[model samples]
Target: AEAYPKVKRNSKFKVLDAADIDFFRSILSSDELVESRSPEELASFNQDWMKKYRGQSNLVLLPNSTEKVSKIMKYCNDNKLAVVPQGGNTDLVGASVPVFDEIILSLKNMNRIRDFDSVSGTFKCDAGVVMRDAHKFLHDHDHIFPLDLPSRNNCHVGGVVSTNAGGLNLLRYGSLHGNVLGLEVVLPNGEIISSINALRKDNTGYDLKQLFIGAEGTIGIITGVSILAAAKPKALNAIFCGIDNFDTVQDLFVKAKGELSEILSAFEFMDRGSIECTIDYLKGLPFPLENHHNFYVLIETSGSNKRHDDEKLSAFLSSALDAKLLSEGVMAKDKADYDRIWTWRKSVPPACNSYGGMYKYDMSLQLKDLYSVSEAVTKRLNEAGLIGDAPKPIVKSVGYGHVGDGNIHLNIAVREFTKEIENLLEPFVYEYIASKKGSISAEHGVGFHKRGHLHYSRSDIEIRFMKDVKRHYDPNGILNPYKYI
Candidate 1:
């Protein structure tokens, strides 16, 4: 770290050179690893899914097995190498991306399903196994994992466990943290903790595996995970309901909790901008109406029987429509229509990205306070001439997300804006989130990008406790350092 100008020796993996890569080649399988120092690949790999925090990486390491990771970690521990363990590389923040072209340990080659206990319905997959693959794996059996999301098509289990990822199903099935029973993690000191106990109640000391979840690879590498699978709902029902007002949708959420508690699996919102972008990017997929709505909700439910589920959803929508809560609503006739309705919501971020640059002010507040915050920020941005610069019919920004969990993916797009405006918007957005006593990072972890603003969500005492935990687990400070602090 002292040798490099800006690099810090925070993690156990070292930034190795071409010669360094040559040194490790003999000890490991030659085909699985690559010593990528090229500017193009490094630049591509250094960025995140959001493309907000692009970084520089020196060498990218690909280890195929837990034993290989163990050996690599041991070697890094001895040589003072700082490592950034990465999976899938689909995180919104720069969690998996290298900070300054330091050595990167890619888990892509480690994809495998190590074991599956049918009796307990527990499945353990390698860190590099993509999420969609896991879904297929479960499909091959007669079971399905309850966790579902837009990213499930690409996200991996390792990254999911590392970030404690929550999705639409989180409202019902709960986060992965509660489902994951055991973990096999390679500690910063190069030791493996393989406790594959699938028992529900283990009064084990400390419940150490919890540390790796949502730690963003700062604590250690989650090589493998054991999680309990859930019974698949036999009857799947998807609904796309259009309401003129966003407030009515919020009201519907409160009422639905009382009325359809068990059937309401996911309650998500799609702003007008999100809808238009989906239409624009995905081609002639209609927005389910003659005109656009202020906010749309894609509500879905899974029940024991399709007839009962469809009847209940239809009855629910009828009540809402009769009450003039929504202009129109449709329950999916089949799986194909169900997937089409979801495309409008699932493809928002990607479509938005194709436009140009974007800045995300993701935060978690009281669901009641979410719209008000968005309104206030939208008003402020308009006042600052951020969007007012354009000609007539300026492109109005949009903000919407998992209303069920109070996590909002608020974003701002300026066709051409100054760095000064960027500076102004950052404080305006984060400060408002702070005033609400909300989380600065709702879904995205505090990995490098949001660490500076952690104080907005956590207190001094809580932060101190977190640092202390990091110290206790990795006293050498050789873990993914300078992150999530």
Candidate 2:
């Protein structure tokens, strides 16, 4: 494994022993309990999706049911052994991986759709259920999971809820906090707390489920989820617009929301650098435009009335063109075209990292200043003599994101991860976002990556309250120790 900066293991947590392994083996089948002589078997669980953070965990427990999970947690908590609750392992931040020798508690084996009520359009399922599988099941019942992402094929529903992932369809369906009704979680002490309710409205005291929705597994392990699915739209269409300037991009967004109104599902933006990186990474995949523009916007509409949606989108586009808000544009003629257009926008993440490494910052900024951070970082790197072709640690800076929601993904692609480059970015990026009254993290939680930098976005009192909540739930701090509270 690649060497990363070493993080000291908490002295309060106990190191796993043979007795602990024996206990896990007793409750789980051989297949469920993984301990390999070769280190490669546990590599997937030890390293994060970004391959930036690595752990030295030798054991990974895959409980087949919540009961098994409770038993394992109870033992770990009693022994004060640190545990990392992991799902699909698709987290961008370093939250899913162990920081040291902490045991990995994977939920992959517990995947199962428990129940679905067609009349109520609510579904209950294990936390390990893949997002794509949930979407397919919902589609069969003429319903849809409100969240949608490029990693849907592997990302688990519980994982998204844990991170409160706001994906492509967030603009139309809202966040997971609003859509998820209840959850079944395993506390650090192995106590099972089930708030699984199918009711749409509940005036009960203290909606406790919300606490764990975006807690990032520091408080507890989520085993099951109850979410309200959305009704499938009858018609969907997409359009790609090339804008001459960032100001015009903002104008187009305002016009789109006003004209497209309720039918607008997504409004994503990509700057020139983002598009160039995507085009380079996806070799042979042409840009959607005939001529290069300073900025690009992907607008999508979904509604029950196909004719009405199509007319609305067309009128909106015409108005945008008439006002000279966009320089060029293209509308999808069919499903194939729609998918192709979205591919360009979704390809930016991987493309930015295609060179060697990518330093990602997912931030919520004021609409007009969304892309300003990326530009500032690029200028700073250039001034520091870090950015260049090969041999240089830094490559280039790119920005893209859900424009309508003011969430910008600022990515700094580099030839490799180096302390010099990291030092230049940290605190600098956080301070800039704080100055703009923007959040340090928008969707991705403050895992191991942003734990120390929480003050950038939250007040001291807010952080203190968060720490108190952590202590109340997991007094021993064995559940995901060394992570953000």
Best by lDDT: 2
Judging by TM-score against the true structure, name the best candidate: 2
Colliding pairs, model 2: none
Candidate 1 residue lDDT tens string, 146-186: 57767887788888889887877788888777899889999
> Model 1, stretches more than 4 Å misplaced?
1-19, 388-396, 414-418
Worst 10 residues of 1 by lDDT: 1-10
Query: Cα lDDT for residue 130, model 2?
Result: 95
lDDT of 2 by residue, 69-88 (tens): 99999999899999999999
Instruction: Indicate the TM-score of model 1.
Output: 0.93
Residue runs of model 2 more than 4 Å from their true location after superposition: 1-6
